[model samples]
Target chain A: MNRETAFNLVLAAVLLAAPVIAFAANEPFYVALATRIAILALAAAGLNLALGFGGLVSFGHAAFFGIGGYVAGIFASHAMYSEPLPFGLPATDQMPVIWLVAALLCALAALPIGAISLRTTGVYFIMITLAFAQMIYYFAISWPAYGGEDGLSIPVRNSFVGLNTANALHFFLICYAVLMAALALTWRIRDSRFGMALQAARQNEVRLAAVGIRPFRIRLTAFVLSAVLTGLAGALFADLNRFASPSMMSWHMSGELIVLVILGGTGRLFGPVAGAILYVLLEYALGGMTERWQLFLGLILLGVVLFARGGVVGLVAGKARYD
Target chain B: MTEPVIEIHNLAKSFGGLRATDDVSLTLRRGEIHALIGPNGAGKSTLIHQICGTLMPDSGSIRLLGQDITTLDAAARAQLGLGRTFQISSLAPDFSVLRNVMLAVQGRQRSSFRFFGNVMADRSLTDPAMKALSQVGLETRAAIPASELSHGERRQLEIAIALALGSKALLLDEPMAGMGKDGSRALTDLLDVLRRDTPILLVEHDMDAVFALADRISVLVYGRIVASGSVAEIRENPEVRAAYLGARP
Candidate 1:
């Protein structure tokens, strides 16, 4: 196996072993921490598809993440009150159902957003995405139906058939499973015909156009797919915390996702997972030492950008053969 | 003779007040190399752009395989089998040489939307791409990244891409711009062989390569075709010599 595949295998094994060891050791908090890593990794992997492979520097991905969070929150809230939605749609709290709805909604939202924002590129593209996310963020705060700024709480965690999701270890396993499946999907896409086109669009748009593959369409498809993955991660995130807030849709959340992608290694299969682990560990460790932990994180990010253009995975695995 | 694969009629383009390509016209017929030779700033590139659908002509129609494609965009024109190589090499630098040509094969096949199949192992793409590479004598260098290739090899790769597209006609811009004597000679040989099946509209400043290979020659001077005839006729025309070839060393 290649070094990247080997490294990914080890990373996956360590993640799986982390929660199992935590459960055996009765460290429920660590299980929750591990779950947070997996969910964040999943979200960052979504951004990686656009940012890393497609060269779309989106700063509005939180809009999809928030959409996914709210989907879970609204469904669970309606189920609690035994009230049908505005369209007379019955509410449900099943994890798979929530995931499907979240993915669909995110895809729908991304279509228009991608179509408009893809017209501009570079910093303008980044600003347009940031602007879209801010619009969604303010709308969520002002709407107030789902507790507005205060957010909605899930009194009971969403149900999964044959699984006791209320248990911290079992919930971590669920998130881990979802993260693995998403990564596998990512792996498949990275080597597919579509993947070749997306990377070509990123590298040289004129060449792609000359070859008769529309760069705009390739990028739009990637943008929408990326949004769908991030949205699903958001649903899982909300269920993990038993809460969904407007904060989930904030610009800082979008920035954090970008940070995670860069930190792990852009375009590397296991980069986001490695990045999420490092980010969470640093946040927890540094947050305990002082409140201004972000200052340190910023310095580290600078170092990575200046010295390690390939990020953590690049450092460990070497440059990708084709990249 | 076979019908002309591409026909440009009364093509004109302007940039502000300066006429870039004024009333330019050309044609590429089967089994022929149509060479467009000119001094720098003579509007050859502009004329080429109009033909490839990168720049819209103010008034003209371009018929490719007898279909009017004057209004089509670059990608649409390319999809209609109008393939071109850039004056400056524009390639996916990160991709392997094989993958670059496979992208062209994929473009020709119009199956870039396939998301599940591993493109590296897909024989449908690889077979055609490999064949194109071999046509250009680049099959052995297929596994290396395109960025690592020497300048001449990038030119060959671009031809391989155009070949893999199954181009009805080719618009090659400055294919031997920065090449040694041997490099240009090898390319001249390749183009001569390529013209047997696919018609070429070659835009080149290399007069040796142009005179040696052109089945028909057109000389453009200051946005107009100053002379058009067989290679022998153009060589004998004093006006063509005075305007272009005579002035060149």
Candidate 2:
């Protein structure tokens, strides 16, 4: 690994592990907060693959996030009450199974979305991806099943391979493990052969073609992989809250995903996670300081975009030059 | 001893009412450096575009090793061993010189679907890529990011990337468009060695480099071939003199 990328990953791991290290045996609230950070980070991490690595600014990741959330909500509710699944596999509150279904569903949805969106680049790509998200958003709103706009309620969180997913601290540990694994996986791809091509296409597509590599196929594959990972996070998120709603898939959720990447750092593997931690904490801290914290949050985010070219990692790592 | 490696016959293309290429035909046998020289807007870039699959012709055919590829897209034609170099140095600025070439090598080998693992971990992609860079005398700079390379080095790296793709025929568009005398001479020397292994269709504006490196020459003017022959024959052709060489200062 390049020194910069390796250093950035190391720094992100420390930051992500900080909360757990400080409060490993903490109060339930602390565990919940750490859990929230990992889940949100996972969603943003998926977005990072497309937005940071591939240069595809997808404003529809919330669809994957919400789709993942609904998988948990829908499955947990049925399994708790012994209702059959659409596929007749018997509803599962198992996190692994829920993650699988959500990934497959999100990837399948992203295939057509990517096919259409990849046709256009720049402003057209941005607008088309946003439009696809809005379509899904409206579908969730119009559908009356599972509470329509109100959302679905998970009676209990999903189970895991062990009983560790039951306790708050244990559940937080599972999410943290998954988050770390995802971070490693993402870091590996960034340095991989395909990753080189993806980054190259982002830099100079015409040049890539002269080298005999087609940019279109390369980017489309990255886009799908991004959707799958982001979708997995969505399932975990629904279980954490015991809820699934249109709010999870709204344009705001998409915006929040981008915000997380920008808040931490773009292109850095830990950027989204750092952004997630800082964002949730900011919301929590500022929410306590004042009721109208959103106004201050907007100002802070604006300050970041205007003054901080790199995100939190950039600030911490002294302007990392990672590929 | 053999049919030409590349042949374009009666290739015609027009945008609206203006003919960009009018019945342009050429042949490049194996191991020959064929130079195409023309003034600005003489349809030289257009011809390169058609050959590289960036633009489609209105009619006629292109054959690589006697296999027709008139309608194939850029990537398909590339798969058939047609490599290209652009006028603008197109490369991944953030990637290392070696990784840039490795992506091309990866394209020629297996598909790029080796997701989840680091491609850097795969020696399969980098070994040949390094060999290609070494051939261009850029192996020492392999670790540096492509963005840090000098313009001349980037031009050399661009050719290395094409070499890693294992192309048998090369379509070079103005390798000396912005180079100095020294840089141009270096490129010409490199081209001389490359021509031994690859059939090159050279589109350039440097008269000295063109005259020195080309085994044969074709002069295009106003979307038409005014004259084509040996370098000495082109210099003496009255039609080429009237249409281009003598028309300008």
Candidate 3:
């Protein structure tokens, strides 16, 4: 069959199977697990915009994700108790308000980070981004205002405009819908004029410069946009779990996001999704079987990187050029 | 007279103890093919680097279309319509040939803040990209990866890329390098056609193509211009022959 036909069939099958798989596993538990996968995938997908296409291997995404989580947790803690937030704006449990704050915070934080990080390329960029993340991670652990190492808890999930977010299954569907919408948006931008320049910049900075495009400006814009998307996912993740922690900002979380992108197929559209599903399943399966499953997990990760050029998407769907 | 596209005055460069470009002055006029020729270690490449803004001269000033542009970076220079092709390396070999040219075209048009969806839908990117490939005569192999193209085709693609950059002038380091007889002929024809609009600064080793295509030839033996005149004038000048031709003698 031709490519378009095959793509249509694959998309149809996946959409058809989503609910069936969620339903077969049971009520809240399976649905909740799927929700977690969707949230993590969303965060990873944001990273993919930079890491996969733009080739910015930033190990600092977790800091943005965690910052987003804290915005939700902090807002809920103040709102549920009818207290005033630091700026005297009444604490808002409204999900839309919280998401906006999270996105803005993430984007603003990314500007300077991008400015400094973008001056260098490849290894230096990676290390500098990681170092900046570490600085924030350390600060979060030290700051005792919101439980510090223990993290802060939200008594209740944030409220959406017309619906209750307290219900587990309803919340699952909400998060899933957002994830799907994000992937669709990602696909659109990847094919747009701006994305064309970003991809070109990634492929050849010198040539791009020779053609009147500045690589620094393009990369910085992409870096900020990528951070904002991940921050949105982080906010959702906090409300889902009813907590936000320093662990979320840790270097390990950043590593896991990178691992997910690589495991699924670095530049493929579904790489983050496939990686998240497989990783979550592996964690669940191995945790049930043994305490030292991480060692085995490391082995599998090595195999994926060394042996498999393309991830599960390549395995099941086929090779995709624009990742 | 129309202003020279590029002008250099008293340009000097020193790498600690060695003088790479010494008191050099030259002008590239509109619609004229200016050629820089010299033997090995004659600093032709260094001077080209200085013009392209990769390296700044320790002393001197440069003007593009009567505006001083000595301090601008490469990207800034390009935005002012100074196009360049690398002498050694090529574009990303892993990406498709169409992709390579599409990138050059995109570099001229978009903001780079884009995220989401397929970039293939942008007609603005495709149109010029196709035109560029057509100019290089590689429209038929646009889908193939750049690494897969033959060496000669890569050279053509390089020119196509410069064309896509929308520069009014092209600084080609050496178009005829490493090409066989047929490849050289192909490139010579391309340059001949290209000179219909954009001026080219040809830095070449091929004496035949240089004599064939250059409107004016400048001979540099030791970072100083020894001769500058029409090709026929240089072919008959004893000083030009003593400085360049006599060495091959």
Best by TM-score: 1
Clashing residue pairs in candidate 1 are none
Encode model 2's per-residue lDDT on A206-232: one tens digit a residue: 866766678888898888889988888
Q: Please say which candidate is ahead in DockQ: 1 or 2.
A: 1
The alpha-carbon deviation from the true structure for residue B48 of candidate 3, after best TM-score superposition, in angstroms, is 1.9
Q: Chain A TM-score per candidate?
A: 0.99, 0.93, 0.93
Error of 2 at A165 (Å): 3.7
lDDT of candidate 1? 0.92
Give the least accurate 10-residue stretch of model 2 chain A, judged by summed lDDT: A314-323
Angstrom error at residue B145, model 1? 0.4
Determine which window of 10 residues in candidate 1 chain B has minimal summed lDDT: B240-249
In model 3, where do residues sit more than 4 Å from their true spots? A1-25, B110-119, B233-249
After superposition of all CA atoms, the RMSD between model 3 and the true structure is 2.5
Worst 10 residues of 3 chain B by lDDT: B110-119
Q: For candidate 1, lDDT tens digit of each residue in A150-265?
A: 99898888989999999998899999999999999988998999999999999999999898999999899999999999999999999999899999999999999999999999
Off by over 4 Å in 1: B246-249
- lDDT by residue (B1-249, candidate 2, tens digit) is 899988999989898888879999998989999999988888998888888898998998999999998888887788788988879888888778888888888778746666656666668887998999999899999988888999899999989988989998988889998898899989999999999999899998888999999999998887888788999998888888777776531
